[model samples]
Target: MKVDKVASSPIPVSQLNQPAYPQTEQPQRPTSVRPQTTIEQAITATAADQLAQLPDIDAEKVTAVKNALARGELELDIHALSSAVMRFHTGHE
Candidate 1:
């Protein structure tokens, strides 16, 4: 019978002395990009301009809306209605 010494294998000297692999380069980004205005600012500016050019409010339309609200005939989701109204009033749509 023969016995083998398996743990006596030698490591390469090149591997021991070699430096680590270089890292990959990343893409450069723009440096002086400006931030955009908020939705509220845009809405306000548009609404102000539109309102300045509008004629006097229609009394009939005001009365119709008031009557509808008083008689529960106007079923409105106020949040959605307000958002839509703001868009229309602002000429943003």
Candidate 2:
């Protein structure tokens, strides 16, 4: 939960006069960011478009379920469902 003051600062101020921080020596990582290749960027855009096209809710399935409920035809095998759910939660096949 630490913030990089140097990175987040509005402007890069010269710290030439300041004494070095007495922290443990670690290899410095490069801060420069490289641009993604055109193909990579295009693939990302295509993936995002595919995700956006997906329905928030499966409308046909929802309608079918609602109709079944209204007709009192919605049957649930409680024991089988419960066992399957329990097995799933316990990570047992």
Candidate 3:
């Protein structure tokens, strides 16, 4: 407000509030994407079913071992089973 110790009006800011040229249309915006893919939906459903079954299993594994055990042909790999269990608990794999 002071120039050479004199009081005077400041320049107007009304000219600064608007664009120099007119705008003709609204700006374009990107569209939203799908919430989930088909594969993702399938995986979610499978995981849900697995959880709802109360117990987890590999069905093919059980079937393969079934007849083998019945015929006394099943073999236990203690080291492999122990390693798998350790990996599951430790999330190392």
C-alpha lDDT score of every prediction, in listed order: 0.86, 0.84, 0.81
Worst lDDT run of 10 residues, candidate 1, spans 7-16
Candidate 2: segments with Cα more than 4 A from true spot: 1-41, 53-55, 72-74
Q: Write the per-residue lDDT of candidate 3 for residues 24-87, one digit (tens) a residue.
A: 9987866965565699899999999989986578888898899798888977788898989989
TM-score for candidate 1, residues paired by index: 0.30
Report the C-alpha displacement of residue 90, candidate 2, in angstroms: 3.1
Please state the error at residue 41 of candidate 3 in Å: 6.8
For residue 71, model 1's alpha carbon misses the true position, in angstroms, by 0.3
Give one digit per residue, the lDDT tens place, for model 2 in 39-92.
889999999999999999999999999999889898777888888998999977
Q: Tell me the TM-score of each prediction against the true structure.
A: 0.30, 0.38, 0.36
By TM-score, the better pick of 2 and 3 is 2
Report the lDDT tens digits of candidate 1 across residue range 1-93.
998877653877677776678677898889988989999999999999999988788889999999998999988788887889989899664
Q: Provide the RMSD of all predictions against the true structure, rounded to 1 decimal.
A: 11.8, 17.6, 8.1
Better of 1 and 2 by lDDT: 1
Candidate 2 structure lDDT: 0.84
